[model samples]
Target chain A: MRKLREMLDKADINQFRFWTQIFFFALFIYGGWWALNWSERLPVFACAFVQDRCGSCYLLGLQHQMTAPVSRMFSLAGLGILTGFLTFLIWFVLLNKAWCGYACPLGTLQDWITKIRSGIGVRRSQYSETGFKRLKRIKYALLILLILIPLAIGNTIFGSGLSHEFEIPFCMICPGRTVLPIFNADFSQLMIDFSTSTKMILTALGMAVTGGFFVGAFVKKRFFCLFCPMSALQYLLSRLSVLRLVKDGGKCTRCNNCVQVCDVGIRQIAENMEKGDILQDDCMLCLKCVAACPENDCLQLKFLNIPVFRSTDTGFFCRMEKKERGI
Target chain B: MASEEQSRMAQSIRMHLAMETEDVLGRISMDEAPQAMGYFYRKLRQFFQQPEGLGHFDKPGIGTFCAQVPLELIEAAGARPVRLCMAAGIWDQAGGELLPAKSCSVVKAMAGMAASQLFFSGVCAVVAPTTCDGKKKCADLIETMGIAVHRLEMPPSKLSRAARNYWRESVETFMAQLQGWTKQKITRKSLHTAIHRRLMATEQFRRLCRLQTKGVLRAVDYFLVTQTGFFDDVEAWTLALSDLCAELEARVAEGRGIEKQNRPRMLLTGSPVLFPNIKVPLWIEQAGGPIVTDELCSATDMFHDAPAYDETCLHDMVSALCDRYLSPCVCACLSPNPDRIRKMISLCRQARVDGVVYQTFSGCLSYAMERNAVAKALADEKLPLLYIETDAGFEDQGQLSTRIDAFIESVQAKRRNF
Candidate 1:
């Protein structure tokens, strides 16, 4: 067991993450060819629009559950909603935000775009601190609207409402709805729907977001993750997750290596000396900070408060040397 | 090529250094001292006994005044980095004639060495980080002595984004200057290799620190091992340290540690305690207190923080190097540095030391100003602290020893009451 841990501590985190991302990308995107059906409520961006997908994103199920009739909210339908949430919670607690980092199909696509940009030697862009502060709130706002709009469409709220087109408000604008289906050789979701004005507007918005996502993620890493409503929802229950990103403040040197490598520009990882639990709302639990930390046991990925992977000088040098050798 | 007067002066300085080195060696020598320590002891003796023949690097030497200048950059440029900070009464006296009497002894000794041209003869150029006023002046002093000097400007504070970017740019500028001086273009591969070499040495240093905290290695031995790294080849120093750690580990396994269980473990902070000037540490040990660990920039802090870069790109690696050298530093020269106090308290807690001994060279105003803050922080933690103000001179050794004994006795009483 100790030998396993030593190997893990010195493992090349980027290689591990790259292969893990590819494995999950294959499992979620192409699992149907093997007749594999995992679940309908995996808390990642496994789009329901993909007909052959093994599982659907929990947000889609959540929106459908919220659009139930008001009278059914207290009945078996309500129990179904509760059970579905518990299932999502169980899946979430197993990996926390790693679902977004390693399993999200849309996230994988964005990483590929980033690789292309880096290959071309184009400098990646990061948001200014003020801009990041302002934009980080958009995810939460989208989360609120996704829940409330679905509820309003199902039942009259503050008067009258009748528009089923707004059923899954976030999914209509989410770029994943249009982008992920391309993997299944389905380009049908790329067009703006002309059936009705409501469908026309929502589908047009989706098309625009998809275009923006392509360009934004090319120049900026993890661009779509900035406004990902699923990320916002996951953070609400982040405290209950068994998996955690823990910081030993006493051991941290505040060298800013973690901040420099963070995809989302989370500076608090290096600055916050008082906090033990370092998982911020924007953190995807990618363990990049742990990989970048040079101090021994300074940053750790702990499950049940036991360190599974912790930062060490030897681990840091090994990873850098591997990168140097192009391994 | 040397004048008769200059040769006589060099001879006098070497004699004084030999006497001081032998005195320190005599005090630290014991029957049970680890055999691995002979390497460090010989290195220290060679440094003083043959100052002219020290630092035999295959590559040209680049002198660095402070720890802020990244050694990896120099190594990447195919030059060896020789840290030139020193502390000795003879050199301080020589430099006192050239500078104001109120300058710190460290800067004074460095200026004295530069003036004599004994140490800087082999160094092709010097990179001086403007960490404090005295060092900024010392850079001028070294330049006046006809040695090439590059001033690496350090930011006043490291907490702000502007400060971090400024430091990165400064480091880049220094890298360019070093490349020009060494006439070697620093490629990504070379930089990565340099970083790896230093990381290996840093790992070994940390292991030695762990052994010291375990009471298997003595404090003076630890200081000597680290101080020898100032001029020794990094790989060689690392190998010797590895041997020392191995021997110490065996001793620990056999339960033959050097420190007595009843001795009060102390944490040393405030100012860099260089070699041949270890009076405070020696007095602490003689007063029944063992320095298990320290927060000195000249020793443990120099190698404690290694650069951790994510990408292999040169831009990302250089940025990581810049932050590694700047952000973690708890130097008293940096303003608005609450991290220093926090670090001192953290070290005390980690080492489980009975007390803290804060030593400030008499003319080191920066560390002197931080004494009250350190005392207040230690007081809040309910740990005893002793603040000593002296210089490279030996006039205050008796007084400092008396104060250290009283502080240790008080700590023992406190431990007993608890």
Candidate 2:
């Protein structure tokens, strides 16, 4: 049975994995949308849902920036937390962020935007292609924070005072509040609970992020990653993940071919240290490097040091390795 | 039809008279036009009159390579590298200062540096690769003896093996002379160490890249790290970098890499930016995006170092360095077949840049040619782009400011859907 499973996996590998990842992710999203009860739909506007909103509100409160509306929102945030926790539990245990690979709504949204953006002006290999594939970790970190911070806050027993609620950590700049269409509604309705002082604080945080992003135009690449606490949080979580792209040192040429394509910022050394594996914490794992890699086996994500896919789904990607051995 | 014809004829006559006036203008002032080389000739004459003045030219440095490498040879032969960059910085220095607005800023700042005594103190030899007229004119201002001047005669074409060989020989001979003059032994170990140091430093550069992985890196930071190649002493840089690497690695290991997440995600593009305009790069990072990969003079994806295969069988690393065909300063610019834009496009595409800000320097005819080529190339790739021309100065804020704003807008627009 094991041999049969391995053999079935062996044929047209990358294509199969790529397709399977897409199929699974699509199914996951379709299922989520189907499950989102009707009354909950538009209420999620300007926010991810009650679960995410409640989490952010409390996190804001912990930061001493929360308003009554924001505080009240947290009373209902159990939903985002529950869904997020359940999804994460499945992701960490069953597939190691296969949620990112096959199911994340935010990740899916980013993919659509990326496609449109690339179609308009971005391309796979038009110019300055370094670290192109690595750009995904920006969101991955955000996702991790969306889960961990709220849980950490909910469990804290620091009693009563405003300082006690400081346990909610992701409040001020949580991207989930800003990125989802649900949040767009929340922002539009000004549903935020606030006194003038608290409102000012929320406004300051909001303006700082919005204004900063606009200014970051000529300023830098992935500027949000610089300040994204979620990115910070995920950077910790990804290290222990099961799946990763690994480099077989013997098959490597140190040509920087992989660095040429990583966008998420995986340093060539970090990738190389992992033996050129792309655990790709910084990466969305969109699989761009797996395509751009010139030498076969020079790049691949592994689970406990085993090749999962090598460029193009052909069962025979070890061509570079074979060629090197001919001598 | 007849009236239009007359009008055209009249316009031609006015143009002819204007030409005469320009000729008379040459006769009138010191910064006049030369009749033969036309305006360039007059600028040349005036430029030479104030040879060591600001904006005149850059002089020789401690070392030499290729055609420019000869100045070092001449200096090492006991003639001081009393090239323009030297005297221009003296208290008495005053190469006819070029206008601030019209000139290239790189040309201006470098000239300004030389004129300020910050550049050419105690330098005694000079070599120059006559790759550009700006450099040639800069050399013309120096009051150095012809014997002291060493001009590297790089075959304008880069591909021919003979030209490469000529460059190699010129460098070797210049190096030998430099050794003779400096009285410092040119040991193989030092050169090897330099190469190895650079290799290691280049490897350590992985930190800036890694930091950006999770979000701590901004686009501006990307630009700074990518261009670390232009700094002095690769060995010292590597040593210093070790500290930075450890700090950043610890952060990443602890999963505390990026400080925040509100910054923009951007792709770096443009012509090979020469120097860190300091403010521009820092501002870019401050403004919220940092650089990632670039197609600058030093940050070539072709960046690599192959160890001498037969280590036991001693090898001359300097010879190896020469063979890189394009060293930091001498590459595409000095090549008989200079095709920097082609290489630039290839690199940008490989890097998956979201946009390109092509900075064209004033008076770089070669770059002018590249402008259209790169635009067309990017257009085909469907990559959004912005082009800015700077004379390499902080003073030209009007043009730079406008271009920068527009560039930021374009990037923001792309980011809006986010």
Candidate 3:
């Protein structure tokens, strides 16, 4: 038991996160085309939950297929689609936005871009408090727009005889539709869909969004994660998550280490005084703050009241020494 | 031989201090004067002497600064643990090559000692704790100079579960390193024995502190007793202190203290005051106010809290070590260092201290930055705290004397009216 405890202490949590990201990134990007025989119609958000080109697009398509035209009520097939959504929610609750931290292929891609940027000695951009707050609202707005546009299209609330191009409204301009296929050695989404003026405009928007995500992620840590519609949805439902981040505020010395190491730059983890559960909206449940906190039991990662990992002074020092040496 | 050197230094300092004492107490050695302070004074002087050559030891000598490093671990590894703390008094030219003028005085003195390899040559390894940026960078510099330097990272937050775990791991790592250096296995038994010895030593030291608080023990005697632990082996030092405590308790029972009655009582707080660097405490006593207690790392701070070790398991012992070290530490490196201020306020109430003499050496930013916060906290309780910023220089003696004298006089006057 002592030997096991020693091994656990020596284990590097960030190393575990790194390999987990790599495993999930490969699975999501290559799984469908390779072995599982999963189709594009398989209503799962794990594939890539990006706005405009995400699993929500497939969900909306399934809703249109199952429900009677102009009727908002769910058919038997629509309940199947709802079950898919429930499955996604269950998975989300299990990890609780750790998908953003450990499984998001796009987030992992952005991290790779950040590493390249750092390798070239390009400093990452930091957002001021007000700037970060203002920009933080974009993801929620995007989520709202994603759900509303698809709902209107499915119900034919707009003019009748609309083109099939309007079927998945968010998917029409999602950057992932153009970008994520590159990982599978597919480049067909790179072509401009000049079939209609609307298709051409959507393709152009996709290209632009892809370019923006690339550059922004290069200059900022997890840049696209800041406005990820999927992240916003996960955060909204995270209250029911069994996975939790706990802070012993009395033990915390307000050292600002949690803030410093936080990829999202959330200060409340350290500054919180009226504390019970301290998961911020921007928190990815990355547990970087847990790894970085020098105080004993100041920050804890709990899975249904069982401690998985905790911040420790020795671990903090070891990580910091590595950071100082630029390891 | 070390004792002889120490007595010589002690004699010189007493003679120098006697020049000032004449104006206050009228021609008497500190021994004959009050509480038999001269004996403890001699002990402190001897401890600081650091013999002509580093004393012969069967095992490696592990040198460290700051109160964070646990000496018992070194002892358990069969290595001699030596405290390398010093003032600018003995710093040689070697220190100037590596450090800028703005560097902390303690680091400069340490660098000088390390570079000369004259006094600190016996140290086979240096266990440097990253308490402040000065010490952290100094450790790096020293490591590059080919000394086997182990950097101990103390988590800035004291009260956290993470900090405690990390400290225990750090102690374990250091223990392993010490065993490797000394080529001896540090058995669980030896580690527990070392911890038990420390607990015993600290208990005796606490007794002296309580006696000092009650005015039966002089400030100088307390300083002497505490600083001796830095040099002497725990067993001998504890026995000596145990004997001293018994003698002091007897005096207390007999209703005998220093000749001067109702003198102003002040609590000393700040940087570690070493031997030969006893000018600050001397001035405080000479000003007609005995320092009833101190919160400095080198003095009462080291003894006030004993590590409550569980003898059952080694891990529990290590946990106790972390808690005890991290808990009492009021070092400026920690954010929201309310414990130091809180301890001071509580000590003031218990010791019936009239004022506080807060000292900070120049360039010791940790204590300097904390001085205002401590003063403000004391102010809220309507306690008078005097901030004295100086170095190991004797040039500031007159200035220190005037401020302390006025502060003591004010306390006395206030008491007379109250």
lDDT of candidate 2 over A231-315, digit per residue (tens) = 3433456666676656654444333334433434344522253345445444545454554454445566566656565542222
The window of 10 residues in a row where model 3 chain A has the poorest summed lDDT is A49-58
Per-candidate Cα RMSD to the true structure, in Å, reads: 3.0, 27.3, 14.1
Q: Which residue pairs collide in model 3, if any?
A: A52-A170, A52-A171, A295-B163, A296-B160, A296-B161, A296-B162, A296-B163, A297-B161, A297-B162, A314-B166
Q: Which sequence of candidate numbers ranks them by lDDT, best first? A: 1, 3, 2
Docking quality tier of candidate 1? medium
Per-model TM-score on C-alpha atoms: 0.92, 0.42, 0.53
Error of 2 at A225 (Å): 56
- Tell me which of candidates 2 and 3 scores higher on lDDT: 3
Candidate 3 C-alpha lDDT tens digits along A96-134: 878778877777887788768766756566677678989
After superposition, candidate 2 runs with Cα above 4 Å error: A1-327, B1-103, B143-149, B206-215, B218-232, B253-276, B298-316, B325-346, B415-418
* Complex DockQ, candidate 1: 0.54
| DockQ by candidate, in order | 0.54, 0.01, 0.01
Clashing pairs in 1: none
Question: What is the per-residue lDDT of model 1 for residues A1-327, given as tens digits with 9 covering 90 to 100?
Answer: 989988999987777888999988888888888898888889999998987788889999999888887799998779899999999999999999989888898998998898888887677887888899999999999999888888997789958775888888789989988988888899989999999999999999999999999999998899999999999999998999999998888877677789978988899999988748888888888888899887789899999988999998778877766765672
lDDT of 3 by residue, B144-198 (tens): 8789898777888776656756776887787778878989887657776776677
For candidate 2, the chain B TM-score comes to 0.65
Report the lDDT of model 1 for residue B413. Answer: 84
